[model samples]
Target: MTDQELQTLVEKVSQESFRQPFCHNARFNQRLKTTGGRYHLQSHDLDFNRLVFEKYGTAELIKVIKHELCHYHLHLAGRGYQHKDLEFKQLLKKTGGSRFAPLLAPVVFQVYQCQQCQKMVKRRRKIDTKKYVCGGCQGKLKFLKTIEA
Candidate 1:
């Protein structure tokens, strides 16, 4: 969805779930690599990872929104908003927000093995066996296979 749509949804969720209007901006942040969402303490803005919706769908995305809202609302009220705080934990459980983001599988990569020591190496980009040697035994490295995981 577009940033405008996300902003509208965030605002709606904030009102319905928290009984508070989210006056700040809410948008998808492509830079969010691991976390599902983030609530800015200074700006009161909400940032969501687009990958959450793309990979897990709307239900999971709503949970993430609620999670961020917990942070947003709690921080604004000058209450305990951190994840470790009792008030934060209680609000999260009450709101049915996800305690942790769903684990995303690591990207597949090419694997190499040392011909002498059989030491394995994995890399996101393919490395030339002619130029690179194994660090373990200073042995020649050979392309093993691609690991899909």
Candidate 2:
């Protein structure tokens, strides 16, 4: 969904689940890697990882929204909003927000193959084949292709 849609959804979730309004911004952050969503303490804005919606669907995204909203509302109300706070934990559990972000799909990365034994190697970044030999057989490695996992 678009950023506008995300903002609306966050607002809706805040109202429905927390009985509060989310006045700040909420948008999809493509740069967010591991977390499902982030709540900016300074701006009171929320950032959601698009991958959560893409891979897990809207239901999961809503849960993440709820999670971030817990932080948003509590922090704005001058209560504890941090993850370690009792209020945060209670609000999160009450709203059924996900306690942890779901594991995203593994990253897409380059693959290399040892020429001698045909063993495979996976790496997030490209490695110079001449410099890094195969661990098992010390065979020269060649670029196979990039694989999306």
Candidate 3:
């Protein structure tokens, strides 16, 4: 969904779930990696990871919005909004918000093969064949990159 649509959804969930109006902006942030969403105390704005919707769908998105709204509302009301706070925990439970961000897809790893021994090696980082040798026979490794995932 577009950022405008996301903003509307956040505002709607805020009102429905928290009984509070989210006056600040809420937008999809492509740069957000692991977190489902974030509430900025300085601006009172909410930034959600677009991947959350893409990977988990609307239901998951709503949960994330609710989670962020808890932070937004509690902080605005001058109550404890941190994760460890009792008020935050109670509000999150009342709203059925996710306690933690959803897990992201595992990163694909590159695989290399030794042509001589036909041994395979897996690595998250790229390896220089010139500097690295195969473990099996100390044979030279060649790039046979394939995603482990």
Better of 1 and 2 by lDDT: 2
The residue-by-residue lDDT of candidate 2 on 55-148, one tens digit each, is 9999999999999998888888899999999999998999999999999867788999999999999999999987999999999999989988
Error of 3 at 115 (Å): 20
Clashing pairs in 1: none
Compose the digit string of candidate 1's lDDT tens values, residues 47-145.
999999999998899999999999998898999999999999999999898999876557789999999999889998999899999998999999988
* Candidate 2: segments with Cα more than 4 A from true spot: 107-149
Estimated TM-score per prediction? 0.74, 0.72, 0.73
Whole-model Cα lDDT per candidate?
Answer: 0.91, 0.92, 0.91
The number of clashing residue pairs in model 2 is 0
> How high a TM-score does candidate 2 get?
0.72
Candidate of highest TM-score: 1
Compose the digit string of candidate 3's lDDT tens values, residues 12-123: 9988998778899999887899899989989999999999999999999999999999999999999999999999999999999999989875777989999899988899
List all candidate RMSDs to the true structure: 3.1, 3.6, 3.6
Model 3 poorest 10 in a row by lDDT? 101-110
